[model samples]
Target: MSKDDDTTQYDGAAGGWGSVRGMLSTFREEADSPAVLRTLMRQNKPGGFMCTSCAWTKPAHPHPFEFCENGAKATLWELTSHRCTPDFFAAHTVGELKGWTDHDLERQGRLTHPMRYDAASDRYLPCSWEDAFEEIGAELAALDPRTAVFYASGHASLETAYLYALFARLYGHNNLPDSSNMCHETTSVALKAVIGAPVGTVAPDDFGQCDAIFFFGQNTGSNSPRFLHTLQECARRGVRIVTFNPVREKGLEVFVNPQHPHEMLTGDGTRISCQYHQVTAGGDIAAMLGLCKHLIAEDDRLRADGRPGVLDHGFIAEHTIGFAEFAAMARNTTWEAIEAASGLARAALLDAAGVYMAAERTIGIYGMGLTQHVHGFENVAGFVNLLLLKGNIGRPGAGISPVRGHSNVQGQRTVGITEKPELAPMDKYRELFGFEPPGETGMNTVDACEGILAGRVKAFVGLGGNFLRAIPEQAAMEQAWTALRLTVQIATKLNRSHLINGRVAFLLPCRGRAEEDVQESGPQTVTMEDSLSRIHGSFSTHEPASPHLLSELAIVAGLAKATLPPNPKVRWDDWTADYAAVRDLIEATYPDQFKDFNKRVFTPGGFHRRNTARDRIWKTGSGKAVFTTPTMLSATSIADAPGRYRLITLRSNDQFNTTIYGYSDRLRGIEGRRNVLLINPRDIERAGLADGQVVALESDAGDGTHREVAGLMVTPFDLPDGCLAGYYPELNPLVPLWLHDIHSKTPASKAVPVRIRS
Candidate 1:
């Protein structure tokens, strides 16, 4: 129980009263009151707004208590009574707050007013919302719209993002970078190339019908606590679960449900993973190929033995293309090559494949672990190849699910928040808004970084996320981002991004998901699309966190009114006041998918958006599932560099993306600090480092130019032999922006080659 000790064993189940204690402690930290208590009770309730945590979908059949431990923590954090007022900023300069930890900055409390950086004062001075909007408008009006970047966070409501996207397009620029560009852009591209859709094929209820589940790369228990409950349910219903990750996370091993009386009282939990394989960092593609190869061999053996074959040849012939070529390519991938690339045994892969062979209905779930690589598309396509082999998709319980990070990251893209602007949306914009939309491909998250550094993108406007901290190579990214003339952030709280100001920086405070967003028309509910492609409505319970705050939709509308040329056709004020009108525009934009969006979104579990891929319809170029046989495993491993190790960034139990809720990582058993790196005992011994040796980790990304983080105390744990792990933002410096996926342009944060300097 020592605050600084890194000796806690990874033995306890994820939940129990530990969850309750954590929840209560977090609530207390938030200055919880009767209002907070009532708001907490309303969370996940029928007809209530959604939790702003992870994107685990709402159940079709609503439960009395549907939220999880982490969800409660997120809610409490957002609803914290403390406010970061204008006086607080006046008391502390931006230069002084620069030294504060990301955790400390967020804990300072909710932002209460609009503020802009004052060069002479060396601080953020309170500014009127209208004045702030006018400043942003003047900047945009002076510059070519293509030179400006408008980024969206994943938590953006569909209504909010629709308006934001409209504003960007109407302003004649598609330089829109979103959080999804960093996380799931590869998931979208790969699925479209292989399975013919960017979304998961399985519904939440499909957990009941799945006979086996393969978890690749993601730590489900910590990242999405509610999803672990789904896994627990699947396990209880006799689903064989196998996980492949570089580290053996506690959540994947054992999970104790706090809601279950027996487990909570007895201090017992359900054993989660039937078999867990510690795949090497940047090795998911090779390992995935290995699994498919073994499956093919097993299918051959079954056919040779005159038993019913494991290969779904009939399904393959009818529903897919390129099987013969893909099968040949898969078999050509030798065990030695796979072992060298993946650091996994041929036998272990065969054993995992055996489970796949036994179960007719299987679901494959993956996360950033697989998608944040140079060959992310290949890694994802490989997973789909494994699923397509058995005709797993288009079935009740069997499919591929890429667990999205944010509550509305998937929804944002569905409603046209994309860098690669589509013609359909352009046509809709022209037809509805009386403006010609831009057709050029715009800057993504990575492109924006390069664009700013190259002096192309002069202005950046962040809709929600901490763009600076979330991206890779923080030092370089900071200089590149802060160099912009105009940087505007529409957010709920003060984060590091706010401190990393530009020449003319403005922080426009916006309402959080937990608070009621009242407009001139009245209290408005926003629409969100969860991970499972279900459209849902979330109505706020607690009043606005600050009287000065505005809804994301209103902010966008205000910006649009200030920036766009006034035309009779564009009803900016009308759309902002009536959010339902925003939804109407969204429905009109995508008529078939968002049909009657307003009526259906307020229902019990909301409405399931139409996924043609789930109905055995292929939307790809081939009009069938296409197999992408990986020609090579290109994700870099630090094996060649003698003193270097493959470093992968992760979120602590208390952290969600760039928002540091606390220093403690309860699930991983670390506390009170974020400066430790988790290395295997074997790696520690090989590096000539002791258990608690203080060291510096330098990136091997750039051409011999050092990018190092010092004072990192090594903590030996159950990580892969040549692997290392550190919490994100701290380790973001070690991840180079150039080291990204070629197709999707996602930063390779999960696989950074770094050397430990003691």
Candidate 2:
């Protein structure tokens, strides 16, 4: 067999010995044995550490090594034995590092010591912490506040996020651009409009109680494997799970939890989905409209029969308004339009609707696939309408759940890490800090890139992320970053963001959450809030890679102290020295939610901030769950030319967000490289294309940009006729910058119109 064929042999099995062997290889090359292991133990415990993975809820039922493949990779990557010492920096030029792959640059290991770009040497030279801070302070203070931007990754702890927010407010700029803008900003925007909150209504435990699950856009088995266990259990209980996505994910079809020893040993994987429907890319609105229309029709029939109304009439009467208009709109919407637009047969949709209506309790879970669209906010709102129609919110078995991608993304947003202006948060800050915060809304990730490219932004300070690769329009993002006066990064390892250096760039080495964080007080613990609004403590099992590395909290405080006017009243140093004090401030700031924050964190599972949705109470202006009338009735497909297909981006099993763990995606039959596109056999024939044919896909949006990718062995599957799919970051350039939701400003990364050229 060829090397590629051998690699494909491991695709979508139990991944037992092969996975262990792969992990061993990764660890052997970059083992975190001594110092790193000692530091890792101090993270996410009651005075401990945080997980470096996505912001999913920490498992309430403790399992040994409660980590996913991506989580394990993230943890190991941080605690790697390899060190990027001053000597290593001296040996490699910034230009040389730029040529490296994402894995190659990170494999060089943990960054040690503060390094500043030396233009003359064309490489980074070790600089003292004090000197680095002094230079950073000088550059930041010199620039107009509006011209400076502070971007944060979700990897940052709450303490660090708080300090960063405080510093940005104090510096007189609310340009607190973050990764959330690129992903779930739509969920936040839509939830706020309909529910008066920006968080999910359901907890992890709610999954156990749900009679059925309606999954939209999210691929749980790969993107969030931990969820597979719950899904598997739900399936065992005979609860149906209906999935709607542009691509049919194999994991969703079948999932075997490796954590379950019995199941793993027996090789008995649970079949997850009762039914899977491949809706057209950007066709969520149509599907939702169809469901709503069916529900409304059912309600009328049930009322006529003298049965209990299908609609939650009592709940609607007491808790919500605007149902009359919304119901009228749903009833008027034609099935022909819904079927034609969604690209699903009317029979298939009605069958799915029957399952939904039959279930007494249902939960709707979505991810970036639903949110990263032109009408993402509307899609979310539509889901809310379906749930509200059945009185699903504020209950044990039903509600909306938007799965967050980053480890502490929810926590970051909870503590004011947003570009959107909030009067309440700003007022509170003013009351506490005695400084008027920036009133104007700041730039998001997309806007930040545009701002930097236009020369409107001068400086960029990223708190732990690979920004250049994360943002769309790679060339423009890189050029804009290089044009900056100063770019400061607080991170564990080298990434593409570090290579795009400014005139005065400082790569500040910081301790990862998996490493022990020791301060003057003692070993410290960080808290992270999960998707379910439950706060959990994380403790690291490893030691610090180097003594010189600083915690994100300490780094933020150090920067603040260096730049801010020296004041006895601020007590910035005290908060930095002891994170417990920072937690105290957080507790004080949100007394209603985080009361006794330090004490509650000691609990194994931690505490949950109560969600009003749990009780079916609508927090909207009318004190009821409201259904939004969509301005458009169908999936807004871009005008494609002859022989063109709409392509959507996907994440492989080995990757998490923008962080690629390995080139092999065993589940999808992809191996060696991320160059192949998943195309329908009919599309292949329609375009006169064959397997292994290298083709350039031209953007149908008139951007004139093209993506070159090789064809794969076409698998005839149940996808929409005109749709094609491929991996992201490689394909992000195909998505136009302007193609985004008006309400959320999240780019339509899931659905970009394109036509293949042989």
Best by TM-score: 1
The local distance difference test score of each candidate is: 0.85, 0.78
> CA lDDT of 552 in candidate 1?
82
lDDT of 1 by residue, 635-669 (tens): 66334567777888999888888888777787777
**lDDT of the structure predicted as candidate 2:** 0.78
Q: Which regions of candidate 2 deviate over 4 angstroms? A: 1-25, 32-49, 635-637, 703-718
Worst 10 residues of 2 by lDDT: 1-10
lDDT of 2 by residue, 272-311 (tens): 8899999988888889888888878988998999998677
**Candidate 1 ranges beyond 4 A from true positions:** 1-8, 637-639
Give the root-mean-square deviation of each candidate in angstroms.
1.8, 2.8
| CA error at residue 293 for candidate 1, angstroms | 1.5
Steric clash count of candidate 2: 49
Q: Whose lDDT is greatest here? A: 1
Residue 358 in candidate 1 has what lDDT?
A: 91
Model 2 lDDT, residue 236, Cα: 97
